[model samples]
Structures are given as structure tokens and as C-alpha cells.
Target: MKQALQLLVLIFSLTVFGQNGNTDTAQVVIPGRYNSVEAQAKPYVIMISADGFRYDYAKKYHAENLLKYSNEGTQAKAMLPSYPSITFPNHWSLITGLYPAHHGLIDNYFYDYKRKEPYAKSNKKNAEDGTWYGGLPLWGLAEKQGMLSASVMWVGSASDAGGARPTYYYPYHEKFSPEEKVNKVIDWLRLPMDRRPHFISLYFPEADANGHHFGPDSKETEEAVHKIDQAVGQLVQKVKELGLKNVNFVFVSDHGMIKADNENPLEIPQLLLDKNRFDIYNSQTLLRVYVKNPDEVKKVYKELKANKTGGYKIYLDKKFPGSLHFSTKDDRYSRIGQILLFPEAPRIFLEKGEKSTAGKHGYSPKTVPEMKATFYAWGSAFKRNITINEFENVNVYPLVAHILGLKINGPVDGKLKVLKETLK
Candidate 1:
């Protein structure tokens, strides 16, 4: 029995060290004025994503509660979302503090022509198998440090990530009532101090769903936002009720919705090409075209470059031109199609039979409103009554990693610069 126990211990250590041998220690570069220890020992951190909530919507629609939160907390001029700016990819980016390419989720849907399988947001097989997701989410980082973490409704939260999962999670399901969702978050906060999570994320999807069914400017959309705000109120009130005083709350969004264009469906006919030449899949605003041969790929690129395209702006994935700030490789979420078809000024991507009443946001991140989103933080650790200049989503991870004391393995695209000004 003693020999068996020793053997088990030996195997476990070897397995542990083997997997973490390459794990990089997180590095901290403190500013001259602030002490590292003080920054490291801050407080509880919570991030919330109100799906499809636009930067202007809150201000324009009289979302006073949210605006008050922003007014009192450290808010940004604008929160620039990542490219394609879809839900799943953007949410994944928020957690990993990585762009889609680095994180491996390019859009809500990806085509695997060889396997004849496509990855969509709700596809159970892809969600459960975990191949569709890449990188470590923020909660996973907190859990690793002996700190508890919880999430109410984050994309991929219920999915297995990096083999282990969140200490607390609730799967995304249509059957979940808004009240139930709010209560679940409140319930998690009610856990005893020893069991309380160091990090928590709450997600509300009503606004996005409503925007999709009814345009962003509609009454239905307004009602949805109000309802979500009430839920936010419930969450904030409960945190106080539970005396979770050492907490910071961040309110953000995936990407704002746009009214769908109904003029003409942006179409790419594979029938126009040699059937053996390309495999085409359309995901809303972008068309992913994968070709069989490199030579054929060149021919396609040339044709797209010289053509008087109808309503599509095309680019070769390997050499996605400047101004887009998007990586060319699809290795992470950055893997773009050989020819990406971005809808013209009045057009958006659509399948043969797809209809959308709500606007979409997969256009270039530079689109005036589409690029714009929200970021507001309030509570114990943040400086009160400060709104800083605009920053991109890439800057978000470092701030989060800093708060949670998690080390990022690679160089973060954005700096700890934003927090430098805000946290002080």
C-alpha cells in the first residue's frame, strides 16, 4: 500500500510539471509612483457584458442608471471592439484579453470544409467538445490561484475550457428567465467569504435578442434595455446586501447592433467558380472562401482586386490591407478567408434564406458606430468620477489580469496604460 501511494504521487508530480513547464510567470511592470503590493491586493472584480449594448444607446436612450454608474466610475470615451465584432469571438477576446486570431474564435461561425462540419454559436457538438474554443478565460486564471470564480451567463462559460472548468457556471439556454438569471448571480454572491469567488461575470442577453428581432431604435429594444437595467439594479443591491464591499463592477458590451439593410442580399455564387476550386461559407457580414489550390487562390485574389464588385469589398487573407488592423492568419480568431467580402456602405452579408430585422456588426472595426462600444467600472478600487479617453478591447485583459494577479504568458497588445490613469 505504501509503495502504491508513492507511485501515485510520483505520477501526479510528473504530469503536473510536464504540462506547466512552459507556463510563463506573469510579469509586472509597476509605475514609479504605485507600489506593486498595493495594486495586487485590491478587491473583488466583476465584469458584466450586456449583449448588443451600444455606447450611445445608454446615453441617447436615457439609461440613467447605467450613465450614473459611468459618471461615478472610471469610464472610457469609447471601447473599441475587435474585428468582425461578432458575439462569440468578441466575448472570447474579452476574457482572454486576446484578439480573435490569438484566441482562435474568428466569428460566430467557422467553416471546416474538409470535415464537412461548420461551427455555429449554439452547435452542441462544437460547444461540448471544446475544439471551437481556445485560450484560458479570466475565471480560469483566478481559480488556478486558489481563488474561487463564478459566472452567471458568459459565452463558452458552460463549455469545458483547458480541460478544467469554472467553479461556478450556468449554461446559456433560452429557457432561462431574466429573473432567474439575476437571482443566480445574487445567489453566487451570497456564498460565504471563504467560498466567495474572487472574480465574477454576469451576462444579460435580452437587449441583443430584442435588437435582432426588433431594430435597436424600436420600443421593444428600449423595453429590453430597461428590463436588463432592473436586473443590474438587483445585482448591485444584492452585493450590498451581502456586504461584498471589496468589489469592483465593470459594465461592458460585445458590439452594438445596426439596422439590417434590406436592399439586396450580398451574394457569392460558388456556382460561378469551378466546383473543385473553392469552398464558400457566409457568416453574416463576411464571406469565408477557402480554396483547394494555392494557384487557384492567386487567380481568385487577382479577379477580386481588378473587378468592379457590386456590393462587396474584397481582400486576400494573407495580405489583408492596412486600415483594418486585423491579422491575416486564421490560426487564432484571425484566420480570415482567402477573399473576405465586407458589405458595402448600404449592404450587409446574408445567406440565401436569412432574414434579420436587427442590425449586424461584422463590418470593419473602423465603422463609425460599430467600432464604438462601452466600458465603465465602479466600486472600491477604481478612482471615483473619472472618464478617460477611448481604448481598444486589447487593453482590457491587462487591467483584468492585473486585478486578479494572473500572469499573461505573452506580450499583451494593449498596455496597462489605461489603468495607470484610472486606478490612480
Candidate 2:
């Protein structure tokens, strides 16, 4: 009877194994020029993105301790963000090497063309439908390569989309403190050698938070950077303490911030405000409207196109003028608004009952220098003491893949030049 039971168990196990074997398909490997069996055997990677950090602040202040990695190792003068220069879209691009269209996260605010409901940035339930984010993030790629990854707080990281969940994830929790974020990273690093992640992102949006509250130039913003600097110090200390050698670290930000006075000088004159013509998303800077019946989107487009007072630009959904250094026209991502009103100077976009205190960024990337994010790379593989200029954030995906010895799928908007020379 015992032998019979054993035989029966064996058959059951075999049947179960065979039945579910194909259910969890193997990860599809997308080959690339950079992808090779040899490239996959390099030192591991540690990527950190601090949202809303500016390049000038690091270059000028020198307070960013980790940013020194950019100078001492391989660095870029500034990282040009995707066209809109907002948080969600640009952060998604940095990881996927694809624009908002290709990666599929069009904006921080979701627009349901069907008008199902307003897409809020922090809404997790609605975000689960898969439209909130697009493409696979770097962490997913690392996991597929048979490596481990951990994301503490990165945009589009909170969800376990496409069954592409990280080995460890600390999704956006409002109650999480900075110390909690830092400690969680240290804990993840301390996991047994086999369990610890090889890819990680450490983010602190306090600077951007302060920028929105106290303006980028204000003391509060500076203090926020100082606090984050200490956070960086703690992270490096833990890395050393945990003995995570052979790890490559890349520190970056989504975009920079602009100083705003909150006063609206370019308020649309009553004559310009056709109740039927304008759906003012931002009466000051970002203006969106559905023109009156019989009025062409282009007619309103032509009017805004000609008016350049507030540093605004008008583009039909099809035409985003200039080589804004992004694949914005791609059909995969969210196309920017029909008319984009970029602010020229210190102006804030105002809404009903909304009060602006400090700095703002949703304007044209060209108009806001702060919209330019920061980039720095160091550790086992990066070359030392070099400064390259105006590296597009899109390019980072390929560069990172090269560093980690992974391959990217799909057509990439970023190139793998300039910075390639920096790596030894």
C-alpha cells in the first residue's frame, strides 16, 4: 500500500507539472546590438532617480554628495526630459528608453478620450487596467535576465503590471517617511546574497515638493536638497556596510523646477475667453479648451500659435513642432494636448481656489531650464572624471542596459553614443 501510494503521488506530481508547465511562459528576450551573452556577464547595476532634481543645482551648489559620482565618474551636463517634462512621463521614459507614446504613460493627469472618469495621478485601482503605464520597466528587464531588482519609489513601479513585479517593491505609500525609505533599501540590500536585488532606484521628491511649495530658489528648496544629501550619505554608508561590491550606481532625476511668482500677468482677456472656445486647464500656463461648434481645433490652434505672450506653443495632435528631442508623434504614447501653453517667465498656472506658492514645471522644456534633470553614474564599470553635455533621458535606457549587460526590445528614441566613450 505504501509503494502504491508513492506511485500515485508521483503520477499526480507529473500530471500537475505537465498541466501548468506552459501557463507561465518564459520571458521573451529581445535581442539588441548591446545584448550579448558576454555583455550579460558584466558587473551589476544600482540605479537611483530623484524626482524634480535640476542639473544646475548640483553643478552650482555641490551639495549633492552622490552627484559627485557624475563628475568623478561618467556624467552628463544635463538630461533633457521628454517633451512635456512632467514627472510620470519622463520617469517612465528613463527606464524604458521609449517616449510617453511608446511607453504609454502620456501625462501625470490621465485623459480618458471616452470620458470614463478623470485619471488621477495617484489612483492605484484605475492604474491597474494597464493604460496608466506602458512598456516594461528596467527592473522587470533585470528580473527577466535571471537577476534581481528592487524599487523603493519610482513612478509606474507601484503596480505589478504584466506580471512584471520586482523581487521587492515599496509602492508609493503616503505614510512612508524618508528614514523608512532609506531603511527599507538597507534592509533589501542586507538580504542574503541570493535574495538581494542587483537593480535599485532611491528617490526623494522632497526637493520637487519644496519647489512646488516654496519656489526652487527659496531656502526651503535648498534645505530639501540638503536633507536628501544626508539621505544619500546614509545609502552609500549602507551599501558599504552591506558589502554590496561590484554594483554600478546611476543617480538621476525626472525633471527640474522653475521659479513661479503665482501672479497671473497673462490672464486671458475676456475677449479671448470664448466660453465655448476655451477649456482652460490652466488660466495662467497650461490652457486646454474645446472650441465652439464649427470652430476647427486648428482655428483655436492658429490663434494660440500666433500668440506667444506667455511662452505658449500650439500644436495640433499630429504636429509637435521642433525636434524636441522626443518621439512625441509616436502613436503608442499619450499625445500632448491640442494646444500647449508654455510659460515664458516666472508664471504659475492657476485654477479655481488653487494657490501657488513656489516653483512649477509643466511648461515647454525649452522655456524652463529647471525642466532639465540631473544625471550621474559611477561604480565598477563607469569611466572616471568626465562631463558630457545635454544627454537625453531616453538615451539612459540603452546606456544602462549596456552597463548591466541586458537587451532592450522595441525601437528606442535615445542613442548610445557620447557616454559610451566614458565607460572603460
CA RMSD per model (angstroms): 11.6, 13.1
Off by over 4 Å in 2: 1-42, 114-117, 127-129, 268-280, 283-285, 290-295, 303-311, 325-328, 331-335
C-alpha displacement of 194 in model 1, angstroms?
2.0
Q: How many residue pairs clash in each candidate?
A: 8, 8
Best-fitting candidate, scored by lDDT? 1
lDDT of 1 by residue, 59-124 (tens): 767776788877888898778888767777888888777777667677666664445556656554
TM-scores for every candidate against the unseen true structure: 0.84, 0.81
Q: Write model 2 residue lDDT over 211-267, tens digit each, in one string.
A: 777777878778878777777767777777876567777888888888776656455
Worst 10 residues of 1 by lDDT: 9-18
- 266 Cα displacement, candidate 1 (Å): 2.7
lDDT (Cα, 0-100) at 194 in candidate 2 = 58
Q: Which residue pairs collide in model 2, if any?
A: 100-333, 101-332, 101-333, 215-358, 256-370, 279-289, 311-342, 312-342
Judge candidate 1 at residue 377 and give its lDDT: 88
What is the overall TM-score of model 1 with all chains considered together? 0.84
